[model samples]
Target: VSHEFKTPINAIEGYTMLLQGEELSPDQEEYVEKILFNTQRLSGLVGNILLLSKLENQNIPMKKTEYRLDEQIRQAFLSLETKWTEKEIGFQVELEEVKYTANEGLFMHIWINLLDNAIKFSPSKGTITMFLKQEQDSVKFILEDEGPGIEDDVKSRIFDKFYQVDGSHKAEGNGLGLALVKRIVDSAGGTIKAENREYGGCRFVIELPKQKDEII
Candidate 1:
């Protein structure tokens, strides 16, 4: 599999590097950004697919490390600042001082994918609210977006691979984002669910155990 995929993947990397070294218009930069994002995503896609296979067979490696969960999420927000700012979107973040033990690098994907969704379907000038805190025996995270909520019928299958909501934003994603999010959450012995917010828009909630190792 590696030999079969090497040539084309190298070509993608070469062209991407060329594109990055040049000056570009905002539109062209956006195009390059998408290309870069997808290229990186494609590289990880194979591993994630394999991880899915591991998940089915009940083999997942949990390399836990201590890190500030609040700082990581704040970095996710900062990383995608341009997208939300362009839409005049506002963020209401309430992150209590909380530390979590998990795969430090891979967990960032959870926040990035979810925040990208919130920014994508959000109305102009909308406010996206987020909260992360440790609660008793579990840590909780919640994100709410001011966009059209998911339809009840499609809600059940939203996390399925290659399933995109049938609407205007249908063309926006390849549908693996949420699926990957679910994979990481599940692998870490956590729970994640989606639902419609009471007033309007979408809500995603996640919970994870607070305790890790007794030796620590």
Candidate 2:
């Protein structure tokens, strides 16, 4: 499997470097750039695959600690600033200062992936609202975007592995982001849900039990 993976990546890097150094016409450069971009994406996909493999084999370890929830979210936004900036999407943050216990790295991945999806589906120049509230027994985290809303038929199966929305989107994804998000949240003793916003676009709500209880 390692040989199977490394071969293509080595080939791509060799070809990409050749294309970059060689003198090519403007049109050819554009085409080569696309190839390079996609090659990078493939590299990232390979990394994700290796990570998933380690996770499946239970080789990954968890390090949990107590931290402020809103601060974690702010860090997520800062890390993902490029994605939002490129799309020119505005964000509405309504997070209150609250502390929670969890593996920060895992939750960072969860937020970036979820927020990236929200920003992708959101319309250009549209607003994405993030709400954090304390409920009776848990904390509610809501991320709502202003993109084309999810169809009723697909909503139920959205979290299923490799289940992309059929026919409407041709976007490049292995459809693993949400699935990973769901799994991580579940393992953390939290719940995640997605729905079409009443006004427009898609909304993802995650409920996490407060760390004070610790019983999960």
Candidate 3:
């Protein structure tokens, strides 16, 4: 199914890019832009679906390497700087230096998805906080966002595949993000959970075991 869809999707995306380069009236350009956006969104959805399938089948292998956890988080935040800035959201980061051994790419997805979600749900000009610390034998990572807290019922299934909370349907996601995050964390011998913060908003807590003996 993925192969079948890829051909036409790629064709549409190619044509859209070509059309965007052509001279057109403002109205025509707007329509073409919309077309391009939806096509790109569809492509992303397809990619996520294919990736989740590979993950579920155990077809993807972890490429573990030594890396500084704090640096990884900082880089992820920096990469999404435009998104948060556009939304006028502020950040409070308190990351402690910690060495970790894991698949750098997969771990990056965790930070990106969580940060993206926080930004998406947060009200404009709201603040998001990220706290990272090294616990006894594991790394504690917490991300909190100034958005509506998750309901009790939705909290349990938030990590389930294709499970979007009631109010998140309008968000630009097909609900695969958290599911992918959970899978990656599980593969790395980590535990993750979400809860409503007392002060408002939601918090995601992840604890990944540290490989103290691994040399970077």
Candidate 4:
């Protein structure tokens, strides 16, 4: 995971710096800066994946607690503030003060992956809306992005391992993030899904049971 994630960032950074050094006009420099900024975003995503892999692979136990869902959502946004700013995207939160039980470290990855996807597909100067609601048996986490929505043909298989949307703006993902997210949520006896919203763009909705259940 580390190698897969870091390789692209390293390449982007190297080329971006090299490009930035050339005696270019203001417009060209702006273009290069966008490249640098995206590379940095990719770096952060890789970092999150590495952290998640370590947490999952290590035998060490995690501190499971009932944490505020809103805070995690905010933390995910806070961590990606730079990426959003660079893309000129706005994030709107409609969070319910709900709590869920999980290892904060592992649970953090879920939000990171979701938010990262949002930032990637969102249009410049677009809005990404997050909805967190508490249901009778679970808490619902929804993220909506304003980019080109996924096609219906790919929607059903999107959560499958190694599955990726093939089109323009489909960021280079190993297809592992969503698969890993499914695994983590399944272990917690939760459910997750992805679909194109009716209005437009892609939406990821996760429903995690508040009560603890042994992972099947």
Task: Name the top TM-score candidate.
Answer: 3
Better of 1 and 4 by lDDT: 1
* Residue-level error in angstroms, candidate 2, position 50: 3.5
lDDT of 4 by residue, 88-165 (tens): 998788998876667887777788877878888788999999999877677789889998888878887776765777
lDDT of each: 0.84, 0.81, 0.89, 0.79
1-216 per-residue lDDT for model 2 (tens digits): 743786788698778879888899999999989888777767756766665566567677878887888888899899889988988999899998878778887788788888878877788899999999888789889999998888888888887777887555545676777877887788788999898877878889999987675432
* lDDT of predicted model 1: 0.84
TM-score of 4: 0.70
- TM-score comparison, 2 vs 4, better candidate: 2
Top lDDT model: 3
lDDT string for model 1 (1-216, tens) is: 734565686689679879978989999988988887777666655555665666567676667788888999999999999999999999899998787778887799899999999999999999999999877778899999989989999988999987899756665676778898898898778899999989999999999877755122
Q: Of the candidates numbered 1 and 2, which has the greater TM-score value?
A: 2
Sort every candidate by lDDT, greatest first: 3, 1, 2, 4
**Weakest 10 consecutive residues of candidate 1 by summed lDDT:** 207-216
Measured with C-alpha atoms, the lDDT of residue 89 in candidate 2 is 91
- The parts of candidate 4 lying over 4 Å away from their true place are 1-62, 167-171, 212-216
Give lDDT tens digits, candidate 3, residues 1-216. 975787899899999899988989999999999988988888877877887888789888777788898999999999999999999999899998887888898899899999999998999999999999977777899999989989898888999988898744645788889999999899888999999999999999999887769543
Stretches > 4 Å off in candidate 3? none
